[model samples]
Each structure stands twice: as C-alpha cells, then as structure tokens.
Target: MNFQKPKVKAPSYELIHKTKNIIDKYSVNTICIESACPNISECFSRNSATFLILGDICTRKCKFCNVKHGKPNIVDSSEPKRVANAINELGLKYVVITSVDRDDLSDYGVSQYVKVTKEIKKINKNIKIELLTPDFHAKKELMDKIINSNPYKLSHNIETVESLYKNIMPGCSYKRSLKVLEYYAKTGILTKSSIMVGLGEKKEELIKTFYDLFNCGVKQISIGQYLSPSFKHHLVIKYYNKKEFDELKEIALDIGFDSVQSGILVRSSYYADKM
Candidate 1:
C-alpha cells in the first residue's frame, strides 16, 4: 500500500519546565504555544518569551497565522493585572506583548494594549516593553498615541513580501506597515519589523523589500521561514537553507540594518533579548 506524501516542516520540541511553571502561575498566554512555534522550547528554556495579549482568539483570519480565528471573548478588564503579574513573576527585564487583530471593539483594542503596558511599567520601572501592534487602521494620530505611550523597541511585522500581501496578509498593507515602522523611528523609537520567507518571494524581491524597509527607517529586522501551522493556510513555497539564511543576513546588514536575525526557525521574538 502506498502512503500519502509527507510534508516537510520543522519537528516540534518538548516544553521547558520553568517557563511552563511561570505560565501556569500567572496565567499568561504565549504565541509560541498557541502558534506552535518551533522555537518554543529553546526560547522558553532561556526564559525569553513573547506574550500574546487580547486572549487566544483572533478576530482577523490571516492564513499564515496559527492563532485561533473566531469571535473573541468580551474584554477582560483585569487582564492587565494578570499580565503584569506574569511579567513580575517571571522576573523578565525584557518582554514583548503582541495581540491578535481585534477589530471587534472600537479603538481596535488599543486601550487594552496601553493599559497592559502601563501596568507592567508600574510593576517595574526599568522593564523594557516592546509592542508588536496591529495597523491601528493606518491612522497616524492613533498610531501616534500608541507610540507616545513609549514602549521600547517598537515592532510591527510586515510579515511577507509585497507580491504576497494580498493573498497572505490581506488585513495588512505593505506600505502601511513600513509607514508604521517609519513613524516610530521618526519619533526616536528604536523601530523594528519582520518578514517571512518560503512564501514564493524571489531573492530580488527580498532585496527590494530590504531597501524599502531601510528607507522607512527600520533599524532591526527578522527573517524566517514560513512553515504552515495548519492545512488551511497558504502552502510553503520553499524553505531557505542555513547558508542561504546567512547570506540574507549579510545583505540586510550591508543595506544598513543595525541588527538582523536570519535563520530557518527565527520568529519576530526569537532571541529578542539580545536586540
């Protein structure tokens, strides 16, 4: 009997005990676990993790994302306390908070983001908060308020090349995302963004995207492979080898990015503490 063809993707890793304990104690949600990110164990074992705020359900159904897509729960007003408690309990000096696109509420669920950051800061004066926010509907003033709150290292992932934006990240606009990065950089924030490979993006297109990001004043960048988390998402076009990833890094640095993380399993928050 013939078996169905096997799909190629990174194998999953075991859980990191310490990180599990922290999550259990404070009830924090992580993108690594919800998204099934392959780098979960390594990052968690090192006590480096990215928090997924606004609950696990996502309002927007992006094909590339692994988070649950459905109508989300009502706003948990006390979530900020729990998030702060988790951060304090983990003793994380550096922390990242990302949320699903919650167009369900007015302000696009930004007030919660602001409240969470403010609460976390109140807990630790010196904690570094990095917010990977949604587009804020591309309104400059809203984006301005979001930035004026002053989180360290503002990042909004562009997610993929321009050609695939329509099909892959429909809720996002390539130009709008670059503008978000540029807006933060212009305001004296250390701005950053990320892009994914293995989405049918050509090398030439990747180079052009790099230049576009540099022109937008992005200082840090992350490049990684796009492995499908489920059968519903777009098929992986190709996975770049380790050498290819290094070559991409060399080109990004040569193009004026201060820091660039390029690897097969790299995610927006992978090894984020070193940045």
Candidate 2:
C-alpha cells in the first residue's frame, strides 16, 4: 500500500536521561525501554512511566512484541520494594505496572503483580495504580489475587484482531485474553485493552474485535499503528491515517467504550492517567 512511517517529535534528551538515571538507580525495568515505545520521551519527560515488573525477559515469543523472549531470571523477592521506591522518587501519583509473561512460574507471575500493587499502595495510598497483565490462562485463582489487590484500573492488551492471532501472537489465545478482561470488568474495576492496527487486519475484523471487547465489558480501548520491531518481526501491512483512527475511535465510542485513544503513537499506557 506504500504507506510511510508516521513522524513523532524528537525526544528530550535531558529529561529522558534524567528519567533513565532514576530507573537505573533503582535497578528496575520498564516496558518503555524494553518495548521501544515511541512515547518514552514524552512520558519520561513528564516524570511518568509504566513500570515493567517481573523482569524484562518473557517466556512467550510473541512475534509483534519487542520485549526479550527466552528463559527469564529467577524472580527477585525484593523487586516490589525497589519498584515502590522508584515510583515514589519519580513523584508520580498514577502508575502503570505490567510484566513479561512468566509462564515458567507456576503462578504465571501473579504474585509479583499483587505484591507490586500492594507495595505501591503501601508507599502512598493516594497513588492510583493501573495494571496491564498477561492472560495467566484466565485462571480465577490467579485473577482473584490481582483483583483483591485493588488496582484503580486493570488492562490487558488484546494486541490484534482475532484473525491475526495465529501469526502475530503465538501461544496467546484471543478468547482467553477477552476472558481476562471480562473477569476484571465484572468486579466493577475499570477495565481496558489495546489493539494494534496495520497488522493486515480488515476493517470489519477490527470492528468485530471492538464489539467483542465491549461485550466483554472493556470500558477503555486504545488503537495504534503497529510498527514492526525489526525486519525479523511482524511486518506492518498498512498505516491508518488520522481520519481512519478518528473513525475507529468514533465507532468504538458508539459501541459504548467509555474512553478511546486512537492514533499512530497511542498505546495501552500512553497518557493512561488522563484517561
């Protein structure tokens, strides 16, 4: 289709360096760096970040993800304290916590999520915490732990349309992801999910996916252009322009999404506090 890559503002080197310094000081990971998020500069400059807990290495090999995939390190028992300290040092009132899939662990890393959320709250009860998590195969026992932790919002990115699951998200089930969101939503917790466009998905397929999520009680959704991490990863089939993203947002809202963020750079945790 001969689509050109979208341009983003140049990152602020000073602020970015400052944010990195704090993160380095605490020895924690962030999806911003691990996933190569285009909005890292903006988020870091604002002194906000989506903390990547449970380590940087993932057990699953999702082709569209930039996070490292392989045997991960042993879970650090003291990570929760460090993460809480980092958030406090950043002076952030809202924090987003996500993790690499820890399928290697029997609990699929749910304990880390719970512990991190609790630790963040312990530091400051007023700080609002949001979690973007792996499916954990939708196990109620595991899901209950996160729910009981009382995060302000819960999110799990669907990532792509169901039809593209086989190629873009190996070992990940679209239905299972939906169930995870539904489980959280049913608890009256604000629930959200994200989708990447330009992965060779059709318009109708995208619409159907939106309806499926809304029906499952996902209240917030973000749609963005999928930039291939590298030539070896999934290829970007097309880039939706501003008009197309606007239309998608309108459609999702019409279908009852309480909030929608759609653009080339929009991501699951981008400007999450504002949402």
Candidate 3:
C-alpha cells in the first residue's frame, strides 16, 4: 500500500514573523518551535507558547519527538531568568513550561522546572503557570518538589496508549506516567494529560485509556493525531479525520474530563489557557 502524507495547513506569515522575532530577541526556546508542532502559528499568533526550559537536547529518544537526543549540554542556570524575561516581554497572562528528560541528572531535572516556575511567578505574580513535566522516573522526592512549585496546572503526557508504550516509548512506563498524573491530581490543582492517536491504537483501547485517566483523577486532557517527526522516527499508522477526533472528544467529556481538546493539531499546550 502506498503511504499518503497527511496534509498540513500552512501557518500565517504574520504569525511566523512575530513569533520568530520574539524567539530571536529573547533567545528563548518553545516546544512549538523545537518540536515543530503543527499549531505553532496559531499558538504563537495568540502570543502564547510552551516554553522549553532546561535545554533543547533530550536524554530520551521518544520515537514521536523531533527534539534532538544524546548527551545534553550543561544546564544553564540563566535559562529560567531568560524564560521569565521572554514571557514578560510577550506580556503573556498564561504560560506553560516543559522540558526534556534529563535522566543523567540526579534530580532528573526536577529542580530546574521548579526554579523556572518560581522565576516566572516572581516576574509577575498574576501570571498563570502550567507545567508539562516528565515523569521523573516516578521518583517520590522529585514529584514532591514539583508539587511544591504549585503551578496553576500540572501535566505529564501519557503520550500513547499502554499497549503501544513498549514499542514506541523505549524508556517510559505507562503505569509510572499514570502515577505521576494521579499524584498531581490529588494535590487539588487542576491536573492534565495528553495522548496521540494514529499509532495503531484501537477505539476500544482508546476508550479504556480515557477511563484510566479519569479514574486516576485527571481533570483535563488533550488528544491529537501523531505526526511522525521523520522517516527515521515511528511511522504514523493512520491519520484520523475531524469527525473521529470529535467523537473522541465527546467520549472524553462523557468520561468526566472537566475540559478536553481533541483534534488533528491539538497538543499538550495548545490553547492551554482555555483548559
């Protein structure tokens, strides 16, 4: 069978230019840019982005991610300050912070996430901060540290259904990721999670996954189609259309999710303020 590349709509020139100017001027990095998210222009056009803290290089090579992998450079202590500065410059009322898995670090880069959140809050006490963090290998101390940071919302993407975890995420565990989200959900702050479809997940399995998250106390969710970063990465098994995504969203809402975003371009941080 021939592979049909999914169509990706072009981003607006004004949005690309404006987002580029901010990125260049502040020397800040966004997951939207680094991950090559399909919704970059939409998010950037709204003057919003998920800031990539800690650095661009990831320790884990998730098959779906475009971010570079390998030995990451030293953690730049100034990164938090710069990120805060960028948010201020953009005059953003809401901000999201996410980072690469720093498996080599003793704290698993948990402290950096906390520091960045603190610095951003310090800049403007009213700014709503959301964190999309790694699972921290499910380390108790690290999870506790993240909870202490008290971001407006806490999220850790399950990434894919449990059945596909082993094949797609070599170093991650579905159980551990759930525990991380469950832990944060128990904190009284809004807890969120995300999953990508079209990597060969079944409708029944996807419905079961939604129940698992709802049962774990997660209140917000994002569901989107998986676009393989490159041919070297995992192949997209299928591209779900709008109708299918809408059905998934309805299932999620019916499953007791307080808010849900499900569409081809929906991402963990896309239109996050609405959730």
Candidate 4:
C-alpha cells in the first residue's frame, strides 16, 4: 500500500444537548468531548461515556490525542463522588474511567483511581468497570493497587505497533505497556487493550501485535481509525475502510481474542458493551 494522506470524512454524528449540559455541570472530562471522538454522539446518547477524572490537563503530550497538556489541574477530592453520581444519574451500567497522564503525582494518581472505582462500585457493584490507564512504566506497586481494586477489566493501550511507540507516545514505552497488560493477564484478570490503524502500521505488524498480545494472555481488543485531533498533532497516514476493519476483526478473533470491537469510528470505550 502506498503511503499517502487519508481522506477524513465529514463529521456527521450528533450529540444530545442534555448529555453535554449534565457533563458540563458536573465538570467531568471525557474522551468524547476532550478528544472530539466521532462516536461521542452514539455513545453519549446511549448514556455511555468514559469519565475523565482527576483533572483535564495531562503532564505528557501525546501526538495523536486532543486532551490538553501542561501543568495538570489539581486533583479534586470531590471528583470521585461527582463521577459516581453522574453514572447513577445517567443510569449507566458499564462505565469506563480514564484520565490525563498525571506523572507529576508520586503514586501516579493511583489513589484517585482507587477512590473513583471504589465510589462507582458503592453506587452499583454490578456496574462493569473498565479502566484505561497510563503506562505507569510498569511500576509493580502501582499495578498491584489498581488490580486489587477489582476492576471488571483493565486496559493499558499499546496504541501503535511496537516500532512506532516513541514517535507516537513519547512518555510511554511499548514494552512497559505490554508488561502492564501481561501482569493483569497472569493474575487472572480480564485484560484488555486498544490500538489504532492509519498510523503507518503495516498489515503484518498489526497481525504480529495480535499474537503478541494473545501470548500475554489478553482476551479483549479494540481497533479504531487514527484521526489527527489537529494539525499540531500526528498526521493521519492511512484510513482503512470498513471492509479492512472487518478483515482485522476476523483476524483478531482467529488469533484468540474472546472479543473484538473494531471499526472506523470505534474508540477504546466506544460501543464497549461487546467486551
């Protein structure tokens, strides 16, 4: 395949104004809003969204994400209750909570992650909790705390193929991420991860990633298109069409993923009910 700029589709999704209003009122951050995710409408309209807790600002800057970076805002003690309340009010059954990278904190914000998940469980123990976490650079102690919290599933994204890690996510190492996922898998947790196409990944490399992750014992995978959030961010290299995504989903299933959510508009947490 020739390397050329991919064509971005016109944004066609719609959001329920009330959903935005409530989130704004609660001061919650979300990938849907913060990242301009294409599936925001469909996800939010269905009362599904990944809650961005702690604060909106990230300490590390990733080339393909839209979450604001620099000095992170203060960690709000009130934030956990607010997020849980919003989940209760919105009547969400499966809630995914993520956040801006907060490496400045000594514990890498594990305290806040624990509090948020604990509060959500208090509101509804049956609520499926999925966490998309920072690399933590494979800190065993931090990983222990997060896993001990008993999330329904744990996800640390290997966002691109191994070769492209540094250029795409400067603060994260591909090995560190895989190690995080590997720890969860070995501990009998339902481990999950995500990746994006259109970031100059080759077909064989993506296939290799599936087997690599499977060898780590992960059971869930999410594949989505990589659209640059802005010109300053990473540029899109190729946009695999719907048929290509379908082929990948089949390949992933064949490679041993118990579940696969792969599509043009798919995000790590979009239509997450599949897993």
Better of 1 and 2 by lDDT: 2
lDDT of 4 by residue, 8-56 (tens): 4433245466677778887778878888887776676677888988788
Compared with the true structure, what per-residue lDDT tens digits does model 2 show for residues 41-96?
88898998999998999999888899999999999999999999999988999999
lDDT of 3 by residue, 1-275 (tens): 34344565666788768767877787878898899998776677788888998889999978889998999989999888889988998889999999999999999999899889999989998999998999998888889999999889999999888999998888999999999989888889899999999999999999989999998899999998898878998998988888888999999998889999998878888899998
Error of 3 at 162 (Å): 0.7
Please give the lDDT score at residue 133 for candidate 3: 95
Please provide TM-scores, in order, for all candidate models, with all chains considered together. Answer: 0.92, 0.97, 0.95, 0.93
The true-versus-predicted C-alpha distance at residue 92 of model 2, in Å, is 0.4
Model 2 poorest ten-residue lDDT run: 1-10
What does each candidate score in C-alpha RMSD?
3.9, 1.1, 2.0, 3.0
Better of 1 and 2 by TM-score: 2
Clashes of 1: 0
Best model per TM-score = 2
List model 1 lDDT by residue over 58-118, tens digit each. 8877788999989999888888898898888778999999998888877877888889999
Off by over 4 Å in 2: 2-4
Per-model clash counts, in order, read: 0, 0, 0, 0
Best by lDDT: 2
